[model samples]
Target: MRIRSNTGKIASVLIVVLSLLVTIPVAYAGDADALAATLSSGDRADADKVRDAGRKPAEVVTFLGVASGMTVIDLIAASGYYTEVLSVAVGEKGKVYAQNGAFVLKMREGANKNDNKELHRMTKAQAVKSVTDAGFEIVAEGEMLRNSEDDRAAYVFAEGMRGNTDRFVLKSRKP
Candidate 1:
């Protein structure tokens, strides 16, 4: 897909798809807290809700610095699991490109008729590295903290550790 240039920004903001939390930033900490509740909300289907234990959608979005009104590319969006959560996170103004892989398409052909595995096939690790290498700075290190919201936040973090998971966030460096 051809991305049109917006204000000549060098593809700075990275919306990572960890399939996975931030604790460091005081301001954004509340983001993780609030979003975790949304992820675990009754709004989600029972089948999808139960998977939160393993997927940790809230934490992943927070760590990746996702917000409302930003276009996100949900690479390898299997069964559109992350895609659903991202849609909520990005709100109506934002858009999510839920691109899945060929293997995923074949496995779940009924999922989407336009399935093309080659569409956005980069691995999560590669995505992280590419963003960082492109001069994207990690402005914060996310950790789910303890508080009244600890239970929900912890549910999002799920034994938080820096290197314990694949989630990441980065921003473009100013030239």
Candidate 2:
């Protein structure tokens, strides 16, 4: 989905990783060199390239163990920086979904600028429960995306919060 929010750089980094592997021909999966190439490729915007050093998207993807032919979903993908990275990581065979909440987009419009009631975010416990309730077994939780400096109270899209907010990677398996 497309997002029109005035979300800053932090929104560019808000990624919720959900991965599922499948057998498919992936040319560049799990290759560090390939990831680096993707990052430096001329096709990418210079603005995105400037942030690569700090965001460490490659390291975070590797830490999450994402590989070729893995279906991945990136939630709150504002500038779609991670989405592009993940798309290349997954290769031609995999699928990547970049999602931005409707509420967030709507809130940015002039008509609903003050409509805070429509904004709903799940707590960590609630997020876990929602997945467990859906019959998926929790397999693992990845902490590579965690930032110790974040006080956990700042708005996720707040300035200076880029790559500094608590993010959970819930790996689950079906019975």
Candidate 3:
């Protein structure tokens, strides 16, 4: 009887421990999904297709040296493609700055004359909200082609014509 009682107690403790382990991972996965959703709403199918075709967001972010709580500045954040991913990777403690060029906004305005301005405005607004929602704050805005002496960006990510190979330039502040 004593041995049987001890075995029963051990089984009950094991069940409780197993239940906790399962629950923890599920909660973490749910949070990750929520963060991903907040970053991009575009047909993930399309993003996946694009990523598969060339560079993936995960790879790009890794190349950019984006660490949690570090500040990242994204240049020419047209349509917030990379902005969403950066926000999620940075988590709640980090910051992501989405900057766009005047030429890009003007081009967007020219392409869709009817709603270009509205769309451009909406894009910037949404990009800001996307990062903020993912727990990041916007630090500054500027053009990618133009260099600012005091930009002090921990890392700068940009989309070039070719692909992800040369699309990013990582910069560190001088001590």
Candidate 4:
């Protein structure tokens, strides 16, 4: 579905698809509170703590349905801020891989600094088609992250692509 922003600049898409095959709930209320606690923990670096306001790691992870004991990967982990959060969220049972360089380079070969590149573009229709084409059924979809003022054509981070860009999430599983 196309969601238009209030300003109507341009609809930034945030798609989420989940397969009914999985019976597990996306997130538990307790888990969300734990994630919030993780964000406020003193173990996190002071610098990283400050970034929480903008990054909203807890909210992002919660929206992604990241729960305890779920393996997760933080590509382009940078300073391992997310890695730490995932590790704690996943507890000792699950694993969190924080990787960069070649691994990240491959997934983002043509991605520009501003994170705006045609090569990385995908319309909502195309995204759904791709998921179905992969033999998975999309059971759930969500517009968790949408920013209309986001200029997808912008070519540099200096232009404010950090939190200004739209992000989509999808959940699917094999039939």
Span of ten consecutive residues with least summed lDDT in model 2: 112-121
TM-score, candidate 2, is: 0.63
Q: Candidate 4, residues 1-175: lDDT per residue as tens digits?
A: 3322111111122213212211223343236566877678757888888767656666656656666656666655656777787666666666677665553334433323332444344555766776678687765554545566765666324445655455555665677
Worst 10 contiguous positions by lDDT, candidate 4: 4-13
Residues 32-103, model 3: lDDT tens digits: 334444434544556544553344454434433454555565555667666666656666676677776665
lDDT for each residue of candidate 2 in 1-175, tens digit (9 for 90 to 100): 2333334322322433344443353555455666777778848888888877657677667655666787878777666888898887787778888888775455543643443221222345655676667777666776656566766666655687755565555566667
Clashing residue pairs in all predictions, respectively, total 7, 0, 0, 9
- Which residue pairs collide in model 1, if any? 20-56, 22-142, 22-143, 23-142, 23-143, 101-117, 102-117
Query: Which 10 consecutive residues of model 1 have the lowest summed lDDT?
Result: 4-13
Model 2 clashing residue pairs (backbone): none
- Which digits, one per residue and each the tens of the lDDT, describe model 1 over residues 1-175? 3322221121112243231121122222228667778777748788888767645667757666667766667665667777888777777677778775565455442433442222323333454566567655444544332123222222222456212333324333323
Residue 24, model 2: lDDT of: 54
Models sorted by TM-score, best on top: 2, 4, 1, 3
List ranges where model 3 is wrong by over 4 Å.
1-53, 108-175
TM per model?
Answer: 0.49, 0.63, 0.38, 0.61
Candidate 3's C-alpha lDDT?
0.39
Compared with the true structure, all predictions reach lDDT values of 0.50, 0.61, 0.39, 0.54
Residue 11 in model 4: lDDT: 18
lDDT rank order: 2, 4, 1, 3
